[model samples]
Target: MPVDSCHFRTKPIHRNTLNPMWNEHFQFTVHFEEMCFLRFAVVENNSSQTTAQRTLPLKALKPGYRHVQLRTQHNESLEVSSLFIYSHRTEEGPAGGATASSLVRFIQVCCF
Candidate 1:
């Protein structure tokens, strides 16, 4: 994702032992609008002696879309990102970014 000119290239975390709250993942390897899958490993980093892993595979999620949110069981968040098919060329989604006032107005209009 592009953030303040830091254009990033995302890659799937093949084996990461993350908090239980993290479910969704972003797959950025495939060509834009193409299908890809998520593969992950849940690990506990605090333990010093041993290696542990929990595999979470993507069975059936819609293609051309990615939604990832990393959060801890305590509701603490680490990171979040997503990519989706709007056009074949990579671009930001509609309403992807907005000011607080604009978002509030949008919410109001949608609700009203």
Candidate 2:
């Protein structure tokens, strides 16, 4: 079976009772029944790794994005099960850049 689309999300797994001022970290859990694919720094699965998810200054995360890629057991890019998602880190997380990013994809039906 070929790879399909995956899901993404970011949730703060913490309690308010604790001091909010303390540094808060984001722990991402990715699961794929088939194998692993690329994790992106952008919505279109672009960019490389970041500080493993952490609290950054407003300017640094001004236009923050994440990407990830999962490698199959055989370490083949084709045998990829991929998932991607993107969200504005904050209200002023930079938007409307006029120059829109490009995207490329090819949907596979099946093998003959």
Candidate 1: count the clashes: 3
The alpha-carbon deviation from the true structure for residue 57 of candidate 1, after best TM-score superposition, in angstroms, is 7.7
Could you report the Cα RMSD, in angstroms, for every candidate shown? Answer: 15.2, 17.8
lDDT, model 2: 0.28
Question: TM-scores for all candidates?
Answer: 0.21, 0.18
User: For model 2, how does the per-residue alpha-carbon lDDT over 1-112 read when each residue is reduced to its tens digit?
Assistant: 1332444433332555222122323322222212333232211123433312222222222223332243433344523333232323211112544222221122111100
lDDT of 1 by residue, 1-112 (tens): 1211111223333464242233333223222212223332223345422232211222344333344343444435545421222111123333668543332210000000
**Ten residues in a row with the worst lDDT in model 2?**
103-112
Sequence-dependent TM-score of model 2: 0.18
Lowest summed lDDT window (length 10), candidate 1: 103-112
